[model samples]
Target: MYYSTDYSSPIGEILIVSDGEAIVGLWFYAQKYFMAGIDDTVPDDDLPIFKKVKKFLDDYFNGLNPRIDFRLEPKGSEFRKKVWKILMEIPYGETLTYGEIASKISSKMSAQAVGGAVGHNPISILIPCHRVVGTNGKLTGYAAGLDKKKELLKIEKILS
Candidate 1:
């Protein structure tokens, strides 16, 4: 079974999903691919994971880089997981180009491929996919929309 809750964030309303024990997804309301591949969830505002995620987000938006220790079980293939792992390594107030992520993973992987994986990241802010940018440092390819992406980066002080 799946549990779900909503968080009112500075950027917008967010829908957080959990598989009882670990968070599986967190999407901005109406985001592109919102809740993609998720199914049969019940409202569960009291899930411990949701509360922890809320606190994590609260700290992040409040200009604190709180250590993230909550369990996450985002569903995806090996390649996507690899990309998401690199995304997690991006510092709280830093950004990386899609090509940079591709080169880190494999010389054979193209920036387009990395961008595709980043675009599909289910955990959003927690995974830090919003930190990926164009090679020239222009923001791009956020499933939650670029404006929201900019807001998140700005909150992190990555964008002035």
Candidate 2:
């Protein structure tokens, strides 16, 4: 069964979901694809994983550059999973362009396809999708909206 808890972050309310052990979803309230793969959940709030995630988020919002110490099970197609794995490689305070990610996948992989995968990423901040920019290094197409994206980047010190 899926368990959930709400976390209040600097940006907004975030719903954190877990399939008992691994983190399955974390999304800003009302953001695109919020709880996309979750069907139902019991609001537990006391799970160990939830505690760890809350602490991670706490350090993250406080500019501590917290490490991803918990297990993640973001559900998606194989292609999207590949893209998210690449997204995790994006260092904090750095950004990668869609074209760059496409090239890593294949010389011929379209930037648009990479964009789609990034857009569907279920675990937002932890997955680092906000670190993706357009070809011109301009911020664009965050599922949580540009404002949240900008705030997250600012937290990562990527934006002044």
Candidate 3:
């Protein structure tokens, strides 16, 4: 079952979702889907993975490179999973464009396809989709909202 909890952060409120075992999503408060079709109730349990996600997020907000050790099952196609795995290789405090990621993963893949996979990332921060930017080094699409994207980039010290 999917459980959710609300957390207040420096950037904004966040909705944390877990499958009772692993956190599945971490969405910003301003996201339209944050309040849509989601059970906002969290069960009273010793959710270790959920707690880890919260802690990682807290450390990230505190300007620390959070050591997150949690399993994630991001729902997507094989190509999408390949893209997300490449995204994970992008070290923290660094940025890459879609074309760069595509080249790193497979020279045959197109930048537009890479961007599409990045946009479809369901696990958000865990997969580090925010690390991808426009080829021109400009901020680009983020499902949680562009403002939150900019905040994440800034917090990770990847943005000016």
lDDT of 2 by residue, 65-126 (tens): 89988899999999999999999999999999999999999998999999999999999899
TM-score of each: 0.97, 0.98, 0.86
Candidate 1, residues 47-158, lDDT tens digits: the string is 8888899999999889899988789888999999999999999998898999999999888989999989999999999999998999789877789888999999899888
Residue range with the least summed lDDT across 10 consecutive positions in model 2: 135-144
> What shift in Å separates residue 77 of candidate 1 from its native position after superposition?
0.9
Top lDDT: which candidate number? Answer: 2
For model 2 the TM-score comes to 0.98
Of models 1 and 3, which has the larger lDDT? 1
At residue 89, candidate 3 shows an lDDT of: 86
Q: How many residue pairs clash in each candidate?
A: 0, 0, 0
Better of 1 and 2 by TM-score: 2
